[model samples]
Target: MEHIVELVGRALLAFLIMMVIARLLGKQTIAQMTYHDFVAAITLGALTANLAFNVQMKIGHMITVLLTFTVIAYLLMILALKNRSLRKWISGQPTMIIQNGKILEGNMRKLKLSLDTLNQELRERNIYNIEEVQFAVLELNGEISILRKPEYLPVTRKDLKLKAGRQWFPIELIMDGKIIQDNLRQNNLTIEWLMSQVQKKGLTIAQVNYAVKSSNGQVYFDRYDDQMPNPIDKE
Candidate 1:
């Protein structure tokens, strides 16, 4: 009754506060989140979450706290954008995890990334072998950006003296144990051919991890293996 009403009121105020503060923080602040940004997000969530359970805190009190944080966060964001020194201080420069096909043991130790963790991230970026990486940077946002050895990179038109056209995304023909008939039709492929191809690989549609159609009239497939070959033969 009365307790429920009070709880509802506090919840509404907390919601309003969060909405206003999030609006003040620009989209990029939320989008390209760095380590500090993640901390701030957690802090804000905890602050609001407590408001609902803590009867001692009033709606106005929560709003004031929210306003204080919003101003500080917004001012710091502006300063970071306008002042290069502040930006560098607030968001530390990207740390080179690997360079020249060699892992920086000191940097890895400093970042607290174990060899196994580093290897996992590399694999996610389609880089299985660390020796193959020319550069591996641990971004401030905790994302690993990789640059592979020149030999491993795609052969550009300049490299082979071949003409290039617009690069296009591949369409998924089957996903999650279901036939994507629309995609098959769009790519001018048939279910019978698809089944035949899968059977050739000793696989069924259930075993396929991905099926994508490239603009070059090629269909690619991947098994459950993340390390599977690219543009897997549909034949």
Candidate 2:
């Protein structure tokens, strides 16, 4: 019983320490975490696990080790931010893998990236044909950034000298038979207006599984029942 109590107490202490350390480190998404950050995370996790279950180990000594690592990581982050050279050394730099529709074999070889992987990355970005890509850069985070030839780019309204109105995202007016009054008020819409739109579609608030009001004052709805024919089939 004493061993179990010690285990639980140590686990709780480790959890608190981890939370405090993480808060000090600030926010970093999985994709944004640098190589150093990744290593620190893994090391801290290992130490915390050992602290939790390793009764033979001293709790105070384990905490000191964990805090030491956290302090070092935090200091490194500060130094990297202040020193550009250190930043580059820590995270590396983006490598140009493709230039002028031609692959840079030397760069690819240095990065240990295969031709098949390059082709797969291109296809993921919807550029199956290498001729369409003017430049492709492999970022330090393992993401590929592509630049297409000017001629292959999509034509925009400004390119055709056509005036386009400002675009707005659709607002959810109702969800799961509940009226979103907050959204309606923010968008300057009324319950009566929403009711009319639902009636036009031969639906009630309860019947509507989801509903959104488009920027152009159009209300789209999905009914709870699947009795309606598929719009794809109609098309």
Candidate 3:
């Protein structure tokens, strides 16, 4: 029982320490994590696990090591942000694997990427044929970025000589029956105005599952009960 209690306590402490270190390292999505970031993450996880499970190891020494790794990782992040040359040296640069509808075999070989893998990545991007790609870059994070040929690209409103109106992101005023007062203030809306809009849809604030104000000054509401008949023909 005593051993179990010590293990639990250690685990909690390690978790809190890891959380603090992660926050200090800043935020980067999995897709955005470069080679150095990946190494640091793995090292941190191993250290944290050891700290949690290895009871014989001195907790203070392990914590000091963890903090040292975090500091180094944070410093590297700062250097990467300020120094372009150092960033390229540490994280590497994006390599062009495809150019002008042709696969660069030499670059692909240098990156240790197989032609099959390249095709698979291209297929994931919805380009089955390499001929459709004007340019393709292998990002440092191992994701492929593709630029489709002009003829293969989707036609936009600009290409059709059509005028496009200004667009705005929708602001959530109410989510899951909870009022978002900050969103209301941001959009210069009031609780009274929101209640009125909810009433217009035959719903009270409590009945609303989601409520958003669109950029075009339109209030869109969805209720908890979605039993309303379809307005459009299914056929």
In lDDT terms, which candidate is top?
3
lDDT of each: 0.81, 0.88, 0.88
- Residue 99 lDDT, candidate 1, scale 0-100: 91
Candidate order (lDDT): 3, 2, 1
Candidate 3 residues lying further than 4 Å off, grouped into runs, are 29-31, 215-217, 228-235
Count: clashes, candidate 3: 0
Scored by TM-score, the top model is: 3
lDDT value for candidate 1? Answer: 0.81
Specify the poorest-scoring 10-residue window by lDDT in model 3.
22-31
lDDT of 2 by residue, 1-235 (tens): 9989999999999899999989888786245677678778899999999999899999989999999999988988887789999988865678999999889999999999999999999899888888999999998778889999998999999999999887678999889879999999998989999999999988888899899977875788988886867545653
Residue clash pairs of candidate 1: none
Q: Best to worst by TM-score, what's the order? A: 3, 2, 1
Candidate 1 versus the native: TM-score? Answer: 0.67
Better of 1 and 3 by lDDT: 3
Model 2 segments beyond 4 Å from truth? 1-23, 169-235
Q: What TM-score would each prediction reach against the true structure?
A: 0.67, 0.71, 0.91
**lDDT of model 2 at position 235:** 35
Clash counts for all predictions: 0, 0, 0
Off by over 4 Å in 1: 157-162, 165-235
